[model samples]
Target: MRSVIIATENLGKFREIKTLLADEFDVFHSLRDFEEKVPVDEDSMLYIENAMKKARKVGDRFGMYAIADDSGLEVEALGGRPGVRSSRYGRSDDERIERLLSELEGVPWEKREAVFRAYLAFYLPEKQRCYVFYGELKGIIGFERKGVGGFGFDPVFYVPEWNRYLAEMTLEEKNVLSHRGRAIRAFKDFHNVRFFRNPTVHRL
Candidate 1:
């Protein structure tokens, strides 16, 4: 694709995706490149559905390849209370974390299993193809914040294998297993297999 746009206003998602695509594309662009933002809501229940919604909206707007992702944490104890509505849970990150912890109050760590999921939808308008990819990270919620890295609930999300919260790991470390990281990598693989076949299409 000559141009690309990420269907999100989130700084975190934008940064992560940009870093992931750095090697694949010499220079990548996102919705931020535009003077006005592309509008889309995460009202869909399924991640892929929401992703596609954003991707199509943005792809049509820019008339270029657009990628959108819908990701969130689903808590088992709460029966997936904050799945797609993760970003809408509260006005601020602190408020959202507090609300989630309050709802998970008195719950044991084992009962607080959660999964961080990401669904990526890439739309190639020229080819009229829409591709979707998914990735997930399994972990539990801790009693309190533990690390100084990551965003959102990363502070409270514990990774048993790593023996720490996601916030504890550096960007490179977290990307090794992060849901968004996995999904972004998958996007690269897709490009290499399908889109990257056109190596003459240089990134701008």
Candidate 2:
């Protein structure tokens, strides 16, 4: 059985990635499982850079494969105000939502175009290689927070394809259309193929 680490302390994300990779991996571990935290500052301007930095740093520290991701909500009207700063915009989730709504208060529905973007990075220490995948869900920002199903900016992110706020969707539904899901699926597919010939290496 091979052990791989998910480079995040976030329980929500840890569970999602565990479920996504459960059937394929023998053992799963998150950064929270370790005694000492790996210090990897997510100060990068781009999501990919942050994701890669976290994964690579963790993998190097433990000599184990690591999976990490960076995601955020980008509003067209704000000129991508909270791209990499989605989690750092406000002190708390409620405060963040309030600030977002305040910023988009005068923006019309048509001008409220927004996108939820995610970038996933996988680091393999033995090979010193990294794989990256990207996904984005396009939609408009809702006038008010609508659902309670997801975390972060789910309540305020509207999905045109589903005709509702992401918070309104079920976990199964969100896993099918959300940015993280898309990125995970892409990485999963690539990993399945990439590891088809290499039996010992497990894909993160």
Candidate 1 has its poorest 10 consecutive residues by lDDT at 195-204
lDDT of 1 by residue, 1-204 (tens): 355787776677788887777776555676767897776876778877888888888888778888888899999999997999899899988899999999989998779999999888888877766787778899999988887877899999999998989999988889888998888777776666645322121111
Whose TM-score is greatest here? 2
Cα-based lDDT at residue 150, candidate 2: 75
Q: Against the unseen true structure, what C-alpha lDDT does each candidate score?
A: 0.81, 0.83
Query: Runs in model 1 with CA error above 4 Å?
Result: 192-204
- Provide the global lDDT of candidate 1 against the true structure: 0.81
Residue-level lDDT tens digits of model 2 in 1-204: 878999998787887777777766889998878999889889989888899889989999999988899989888899997988998999878899999999989889899988888888888899888888777899988889897887788898888878888889887788888888888888878855554322122222
**What pairs collide in candidate 2?**
none
> Which ranges in model 2 have alpha carbons more than 4 Å from their true place?
192-204
- For residue 22, what is the lDDT in candidate 1? 72
